[model samples]
Target: MPRSLPPLNAVKAFECAGRHQSLSAAAAELGVTHGAISRQVKILEDWLGTGLFIREGRGIELTVDGRQFLKEATKLLDGLALAAERLSGGPKSRVLRINAPQTFTMRWLIPRLSAFSVAHPGIEVRLSASIEPIDKITGHFDLAIRRGAMGADSTPFLSETCVPVASPDLLKTTPVSRVTDLTAHTLLHAESVADLWQRWLDLAGYRKLQGKAQLRFEPLYHSLQAAIDGAGIAMGPSALVATDIMAGRLVALFPDLPLPLDDFHFFVPPGAATRHVRVFQRWLLDMGLAQSPRPP
Candidate 1:
């Protein structure tokens, strides 16, 4: 005689709820209602004759049995997904999920993504903007583009230099012929790169410039936009501001004083690169190289 199995929907509800530790979160992930998830979980608990969760004040905790069950359930669910994906003819119409910073997405990747789309019509690219560091083990990201020194685990894609930029109109109004002339105008600052001005100033041999009117933004994208709108001079990374400079929207101030900054790197989950990921990576690297400023 064969052993009977529990309800798949109830098992799924328990697995999702156990992983998130919140029925609401599980409901959101599964595209179901809170009550539905609660009912399914209750049914699962009754079938097993064990309490899976300890309900607390607006929260739930997994019991020992629940924890052990979740571990096994997760493995089983993952295996099922893998089997389904393989049987469905893998990589035929896969979605490549990419997470990158707001500044990079706005000024760099989004602008050039159309070409990638044109080239690979079958592969869909989904982008999510985040400045927080990628957590490979827990995150649902295929690839992450970040600006920093490349670690042993990451691959460097584009090297960058930091330069001051402002709208052409602003440059005309407040002529900055030399480094010291910047003292007369507002200095736009991005919180992410707060010390960029100081670093650029140091490179230009201006150690003791007096305080100027300053406008600070939390993200580099906001500061870049402010610079483009003639609000103030901003420290622009070469990889990000190249297109703006070429288009005559923003003018590079003191082009001679370029400060070497961290290169952009591509981080992927630990595994062999899939066909979709490999093609995208190649396209991005080529685009970055082409857009980089040529040596004079």
Candidate 2:
């Protein structure tokens, strides 16, 4: 018996739009115009005799039926892609696009990305950096990493702990032996994590404490570099500065007073579970577990 099916093109359009929750994003993904995606979705809706989308002001949302259908459609598409790859015999070489914060990219992921390359020579990583919040970042990416409260679909990979760090020369010139000692030394600030210093200070029972001076920089990496140059003490996230601390470039001050910050999370888009993406995700989790003190 032949199993009746919806038009695959229409189904693909609906599935993409449903996953992204936006027609424009779906059109971008499918290399079609917005009107084309709208027409295809309407075709699918008409063919099925149901309303798959409810139009809101300047946007659309999946109907209950559409939401339900999208799950099966996504799975079906993923299975089909996998079957095609298997039928072709072996995995295909591809690029995996990843977006992360500028400082984390420069100080952390870039240094560790070579291991992934060695493990999977066929898949190349296309990395991009941003200082904007994850939701505000506009671009196409297979995966994205952000340091904050975990979202529902995000996987927490690394824990962040904040501590004060300074160059050896700075310590010699203006020592920070305790919480109150910061009052005598300059403090370095990063625009991205501007609250870190205040948060740590409050936790250390010095809510009103003020440093002698302050130096502010954007993207975090600059402030850390400034700290290394003996300009001031910077609040260092443990994961980002472990290498510098280990290499004697920056010294961790009051190691026992580390302030816990949000964990880093990686988010994968719906229907993006290709073999290469899965492999890279696993490799990332493994790396995080191995390097991060946080338990799996």
Candidate 3:
């Protein structure tokens, strides 16, 4: 009988877990949940029919079988990567296909992509900018970054929250002193959801205000840019606009917590997690976790 081949991801994950000696650490490196790395390691162990590691107090120590397999798995991963490199283009040339919103990509993700590429040399990043949701089951992309709370199941990734922001200059010397002061400025509305302004008004305790504000595009990015250009005050996504806020181009407008949405997330299609993808995910998460605002 021919030997059964284990799942490629399971093997790759197991190799990382063994090398790191901690599933959580491997997860951080791979930009996946700790549970995901653990399950993959278990799947690999089941196929090999041997214990790979024994869980210790805080971390696990490699078992005898694990140590032996580590050597072989290490070689296997290296060989597979080399083979893929040659077959695709070269070891220095890998591709990471990402689908994100056009405005978000332009204003936020695009500026940071060069840094990612520098860290993971020779990888070509192919970006498909759209507001349309990616069908992970259909492999629309190898990676995705979306915004959402903790409990969302549609995506493998989650974002912090949305925050109200506008250029710092708008805040100073203007009569718009408090949350209610916002009524004086042109409230830019570029959200696809028709009720966005209403929800923001409710958050600001002005839901029943006497007049409505200015409105614009369905996609928020355009209006966000308008806000930057002093067109009006626009609610900015914390994930995509942190750099802007930090640069003093934008500042949070209110103390009240903003409304939450589970619209954004990152998804890696089944069988689509590649080394290049793994590298990119790590970089993205680092930026997100460090720069993102608290979830409302």
Between which residue pairs do clashes occur in model 2?
Answer: none
Range of the 10 consecutive residues with the lowest summed lDDT in candidate 2:
148-157
Local distance difference test, each candidate: 0.81, 0.83, 0.70
lDDT of 3 by residue, 1-296 (tens): 99778898998788877764667656755668889998998888888889999998767889999999888987878677769777987667777888776776887789887788777777899998765555532566777655442122223333545656777676675645566667677777775655666777787677875324575777778888887887777877666677788788888765457676554556555456677775676576566555653342
**Runs off by more than 4 Å, candidate 3:** 1-90, 136-140, 148-158, 210-212, 293-296
Best by TM-score: 2
User: Candidate 3 clash total?
Assistant: 5
Which of the predicted structures, 1 or 3, would earn the higher lDDT when compared with the native? 1
Which digits, one per residue and each the tens of the lDDT, describe model 1 over residues 1-296? 98888789999989877865777656755667889989999999999999999999877889999999888987887678667767988646768989888889988999989988888776798998887767643356877888883344455667889899999998788898888888888999999888998988888888777437999999998999999999989999987898899999999887777999988887665442455675686677677667663342
TM-score of each model, in listed order: 0.67, 0.69, 0.68
lDDT of 3 at 127: 90
lDDT of 2 by residue, 1-296 (tens): 99889899999889878865778756655667889999999999999999999999868888899989998987888788778886998677788999888899999999998978887787989999874666676447888888874345566778879899999888888777778898888899999889999998888888899999999997799999999999999999999999999999999998888899888877766556555775676677677777785651
Let me know the TM-score candidate 2 reaches against the reference structure. Answer: 0.69
Candidate 3 has which clashing residue pairs, if any? 144-266, 146-264, 146-265, 147-264, 147-265
